[model samples]
Target: MKKVRKILCCVFATVLMLSACVDEEIPNRNTPLGNFEALWQLMDQHYCFFDYKQKELGIDWNEIHDRYYKRITPYMNNEQLFEVLCAMLGELKDGHVNLGASFNYGRNWSFWEDYPENYHDSIARSYLGHDYYIASSLKYKILDDNVGYVRVESFSDAIGDGNISDMLTKLAICRGLIIDVRNNGGGQLTYAHKLASHFTNEKQHVGYVYHKTGKGHNDFSPMKSEYIEPAKGVRWQKKVVILTNRKCYSATNDFVKCMHTFPNVTLMGDKTGGGSGMPFTQEIPNGWSVRFSAVVFLDKDYQQIEFGIEPDITVMMNKADVLKGKDTLIEKARDFFKD
Candidate 1:
């Protein structure tokens, strides 16, 4: 695990160095047109997924610039300018891209918002009952049929390696384990890696990551292979099911990607809400800051996960199951263990 961490750190350091070498010289002016030009130029130079998005979504960045440029008026108010800028950023169709201001944090959330939310917190909590044990942000309990259930609400908080080792130890007696990360919006990447490490007994190649090396839309650093080393502590030897939904995003998306590589781990439920891009923040001419995806992460097959990963078993929430206070995905995972 430490070796993996060091390698990832070096990769990030390389990205930082490469970013510093670029000459991004947008003028620092407060006017609407000036801010618009600054934001457009900044995204043009830094955003990493232009080529991918162009092919996938038919987004011609140059055409986008021409279309949005006409909307910028000298007499436009800050709100109007914000709307236009937000709309322009929306063209990328990325949840990682955002425009931050005092009044709002503009984002494109169609990744999850447009899909059927297959998760119900009430139903999930009912499965946990009132006696679940809490280890940091992990809420876990043994179900009636001896299936261990762990609900990870978010990765925003740090989940130490020790916490995970202990949690797994307590649930070690179960026939199988279910890791449910339904609505996790994501937090630190290290936390995601930490939880995923326990599932694999051997060091495994998980994916590749690369950052922009030049201002050109297609310019990028050579892909760096990402690996996940086996956890130094207790590892789950039994069949493990990871339940996901459209609400699972960012670091959680990365977690699903890693677990998909493990032989014992089966991904069940809806596809994850993908935000595979590593975002970087830069200030425009105005005081507001713009956040855009600067680094790209791909799965072990070198395929894009930015559009979400498909589960090994696709399960949807049934209205009848919901009415009975049962989580359809959780029940499906439990049935999987039985089979």
Candidate 2:
């Protein structure tokens, strides 16, 4: 019986070796249908919001494929093909999703389209005036009412420990602080997270992040808790008013999320442009780079923030106020800060 088992094992090993030596034909990646399949499979497997989107946005992935497949043809040009793919991706309505090529790129900006432009660079500059202090990338000045007004146009710029220390130290005597982030399109989340950390005294749970683990859309790893540890630098001790608007997105949106966890922080202005997904990029067979939200994040209570977060006070810039070169949101924040 042992001799027979040894003979059978040898026969199996021989067959496996012969199978391994055979060459397999790779799929054609240059064809239109081929590129389509690559992009489709990439999103189908890795997009983080499939399950959530189907439930909330009623996105039928299979149906989208069937509808868009007709647009692909063997004779279509690259531009024509790219347009079709962009149109297909537009259905997601997620700003984190994008397709980039050497010629042009695709994105969805309806998050702020048709919404009020609640922030103006000219107005912010007026508030800062000639003597406004500059600490690294931060622009700050004291309001007439003894409130500190800090306008952070974008998180794209980096801020350091010394920068925060200097800004906070100068504004320490103010009754309250206004962190205005309107029209801030967002960039590095590290800056936003680090900035938000200064408002809290202890470790804070801001949200949870989940990533894909399999090809199935529903397959996801367990949600990982996200925390913002208190900063080692100067922490603001006074009340805080975070001014936001429809233009605040990406890391800025996340900044608002983190601030929501703090008791001293109050959001005043328009709803944020929601873009909670953590983006991941890939290149298709045609060399075009495609990006999608590969991770899902929920608020501290496990709520979806993909649409956006609302401010405690929904303040808008009144036409009269704007004509007079005054920002209503800033004025409202100043009133809230009055002691």
Candidate 3:
């Protein structure tokens, strides 16, 4: 755990230093055109996925600037400028890209909004019942079939190692474990790594990360290998099923990526809502902050995970099952343990 912590710290520090060093000079003007130029230049120089998005979503950043530039008028109000800027950022179709202002948060959620949501809170709660044990943000209980069920709603809160160790110890008697991260929209990356560390027995190379090096869209540092060391405490060795949905994003997306590397772990349900890029924020001339993906993370196969990860066994929520007061994904996971 200490080694993993150290490595993560180093990675983050390096990214921060690199970002500081390559800082571009944008004029600090409060006019609408001035703010627009600053925001566009900021994203043009720092945003990591321009090339990938160009290929995947046909997003030409240069062309976007010209098109949105025409929409920005010197006489426009703050709200109108905000709308135009938000629309420009939306061209990338990235969930991590957001424009934060005092009045509103501008974002693109097409990543999950366009897909089938394979989760239901009411049905999921029914599976946990009213007697589930709460360990920090984790809700867990043993099922009638001797299977263990763990529900992780979000990673917004930090979870202690002791909490995880005790949870695993309690579920040790179960034949298999179901870790449902269905609507987890992500929080701390460390928590995602912490939970995934308990599933592996050895240090494993999970992926690679690339941080920007210069002002160019393609100016990325050489891909650096990322590894996950096994947890020092109690670990789950039996079959583990990870239930995912379109709402699984950011750190949750990272958790799914890490868990995908374990041989005993199976990803089930809809594809994850990918926000694989590490986000960094810079203030525009208008006092509004612009947050964009500054670092890129790729899987071990060197494939881009910024869009999302496909499940090994794709399972959609069954309307029939929901009508009967059951979660299809949980039922599927339980049935998998029986096999």
Every candidate's CA RMSD: 10.2, 3.3, 10.3
Q: TM-score per candidate, in order?
A: 0.92, 0.91, 0.92
Report how far off residue 167 is in candidate 1 (Å): 0.7
Residue-by-residue lDDT tens digits, candidate 3, 1-339: 999999999999999888866554788889999999999999999999988988888888889999999999999999999999999999988889999999999999998889888888888898789999998999999999999999999998988888999999999999999999998999998999999999999998999999999999899899999999999998899999999998899999999999999999999999999999989989997789889999888889999988889998989999999899888999999999998
- lDDT for each residue of candidate 2 in 222-276, tens digit (9 for 90 to 100): 9999999999999987799999998888889999999988999999999999888
Candidate 1: give the clashing pairs. Answer: none
Candidate 2 or 1, higher lDDT: 1
**Candidate topping lDDT:** 1
Residue 39 displacement in candidate 2 (angstroms): 1.0
User: Any idea how many clashes model 1 has?
Assistant: 0
Cα RMSD for predicted model 1:
10.2
Where does candidate 1 stray beyond 4 Å?
1-24
How far off is residue 249 in model 3, in Å? 0.7
In terms of lDDT, which candidate is stronger, 2 or 3? 3
Off by over 4 Å in 2: 1-28
